[model samples]
Target: MIKSTQQSDNERWDGEGGSQIAELAKSLAIEELEEADRRILAFLGASVLCLWDELPDDARQKVLNRELVQSSFDASVVRARIALLFK
Candidate 1:
């Protein structure tokens, strides 16, 4: 369900779309990741951010209680912290 939706969102974002994370990452001159890798990462980031954007305001304050958010992070506090940008 959401997986397919996210894949489509990723594709759309890779095309004619603008996002904060992509803008911030675009300024980096580092060669660690190629442009392709950067795009792939950006698409994945869009999926997560879009997911978080759909949540209710109250749930946004305490995402740990939301199974969708928790499962999306897979119990990784570090990974989940990235979504805190919305909070």
Candidate 2:
């Protein structure tokens, strides 16, 4: 499906928020990912807000483990992990 272009939140909303977190998630310096990846990451972040506690312990650990991997990571892998994270 096509993504929305309109403002999604008050004050700030452009999917760059996820890029900022992805930037901060690293121990060493890293460049921002493409906007699509950032948008996916932002959705992941948002999903975690609502779904984290609802997941079983094993599933949660599996996801957290995936997220703890290297910064030069694949967005698809991260997306899969996020999907599994909340499943």
Candidate 3:
């Protein structure tokens, strides 16, 4: 099942004895996770980045659409426009 696979992946990621490439793959797997699930995985990933000399491919691509980025951008633009009006 999908849930079991995901759990197993996390377990594998947390396990020891992988090469740098293996660890990178694990981090990439975590990057695609849901936000609630991502919280701890993000910490684990940051630890890997800090401890390991090598990093995985940049985790920029979203597994799904993320509206938050556009929403925040819109808010920031509105705030800037408002600030200009007050200035």
Candidate 4:
């Protein structure tokens, strides 16, 4: 018998990753983190439908500034929708 050389993503994450994330989330300051640890912070903050519920409360508060981003994103949609509708 031989050990498999490859492992699935689930098996990889079944180790200490969850605890590491929890520990990181507890200490993370999203504003500072986003600039410093961009991808990991982003991965922590992102969610389906833009909810970002996975982030810790402190990190979430600092990271989830959707009003401005949402407004800006919505503005583009609104602009495109009305671009030819009215003019």
Count the clashes in each prediction. Answer: 0, 0, 0, 0
Q: Report the C-alpha lDDT of model 3 over 2-84, residue by residue, as the tens digit.
A: 99999888778657333544544444434444564456445655776685545433443221114433334343354455457
Q: Global lDDT for candidate 4?
A: 0.45
Candidate 3: where are CA atoms >4 Å away?
1-33, 54-87
- Candidate 3, residue 63: CA error in Å? 19
TM match of model 2 to true structure: 0.43
lDDT by residue (tens digit), candidate 2, 15-51: 5354445454674222345566567677766887689
TM-score of 3: 0.23
Error of 4 at 42 (Å): 11
Better of 1 and 4 by lDDT: 1
For candidate 3, the 10 contiguous residues with the lowest summed lDDT are 60-69
Instruction: Name the TM-score of candidate 4.
Output: 0.21
The alpha-carbon root-mean-square deviation between model 4 and the true structure, to one decimal in Å, is 15.1
CA lDDT for candidate 2: 0.56
TM-scores of the models, in the given order?
0.28, 0.43, 0.23, 0.21
When sorted by lDDT, best at the front, the candidate numbers are 2, 1, 3, 4
Report the C-alpha displacement of residue 81, candidate 3, in angstroms: 46
Better of 1 and 2 by lDDT: 2
Q: What local distance difference test score does each model get?
A: 0.54, 0.56, 0.49, 0.45
Model 4: per-residue lDDT, tens digit, 1-87?
134434454457557254545554454343443243455435434642176455467765444344443344343353454445546
RMSD in Å for all candidates: 12.9, 10.2, 15.3, 15.1
